[model samples]
Target: MDLLEAIRKRRSVREYTGEPVDDAVLRELIEAAVQAPSAINQQPWTFVVIKDADRLAQISRKAKSHLLKASLSEPAHSFREMLNDPDFDIFYHAPALVVIAAADPTDWAVEDCALAAENLMLAAYAMDLGTCWIGFAQNWLATPEGKAELGIPATYAPIAPIVVGHPRRPPPPVPRKNPDILWIDAQTHCA
Candidate 1:
């Protein structure tokens, strides 16, 4: 698929099928993700591919628990609702959950990780896979139990979880912004 088309078609999918993603295809997606440019080519990122259903469910529950404790009252309510929903999973039933972890807090690793994540999401779309960026995992990883549960080390900061699977339904393309709103080259001269 064309790059622009993949970028345009990419959406934050919430619903996914239980279809299993092939190892080769998933590896290719991760390979594409790491191709993104990084500051000084640090490439300070690692990924944890969570495929176990039990672990995924636990993560979902603990994440909601941590969010509630952090005063995220709304999410707590949402979590309660999700628990009862048949489709509710930490990763929305995606077969794979790619947890992005960045090293070095002051080295601008977050930006690099974001670029990589965009690559992964777009690549997945091109390969007919769906992805949802789970930011809630970040705050959860900061909690004591979440750290032990996810096996994230102290040196690595949890960035985002890229949930990968087959989309249950095609999502509509998001609206684009006006290019003029971004002033790329505002000519100014000082005397």
Candidate 2:
């Protein structure tokens, strides 16, 4: 698919068909992710690909439990309510999860990881695959036990937990908000 087409078509797919993504396709997505630019060319990121169905289910359960015990701030009320649903799966039963981590806890770590994540999502869309960044798993995946279970290094920070799979159906195009642009000419700046 063309770059623009991929960008326009990419959406946060919550529902998946339970079909496992091919290993080669998953590798290509990760390759696309790493191709993303990083701060000062410091490609400080690590990726953990989880394909085990049992482990994915376990993660969903743990994340939901953690979310329920979290403080009920007004902004989080809706999310808390969603977690209350016993059948709600944070990953939406996606067959694969690509957990992107910051290799070092630098100031630009999160930003760097975000760029890679966007690349991965776009690449997946281009390949007729679906992806959703699971923010609810961030806190839980960073905990000691979470890290140990996932085998993430102590120095690495779990930045993006993206679930990947085949979409049950292609989502219709959604409208985009107008761009907020501010153009300043060089001549106007020198007062």
Using lDDT, give the best candidate's number.
2
Q: Model 2 scores what on Cα lDDT?
A: 0.90
Off by over 4 Å in 2: 187-191
Point out the worst 10-residue segment of candidate 2 by lDDT.
Answer: 182-191
lDDT of 2 by residue, 52-85 (tens): 9989989888988887787767887878768988
Q: Which 10 consecutive residues of model 1 have the lowest summed lDDT?
A: 182-191
Give me candidate 1's TM-score against the actual structure. 0.86
Expressed as tens digits, the lDDT of each residue in 1-191 for candidate 1 is: 88888877789998888888988888898999999998998898888788887888778877766665665566456665554554556678788888777866747888999999999999999888899998666788756676667787776787878899999998887898867664445585555
Angstrom error of the Cα, residue 85, model 2: value is 1.2
Q: In model 2, how large is the Cα lDDT of residue 52? A: 96
Name the candidate that leads on TM-score. 2
- Global lDDT of each candidate: 0.81, 0.90
lDDT for position 67 in model 1 = 61
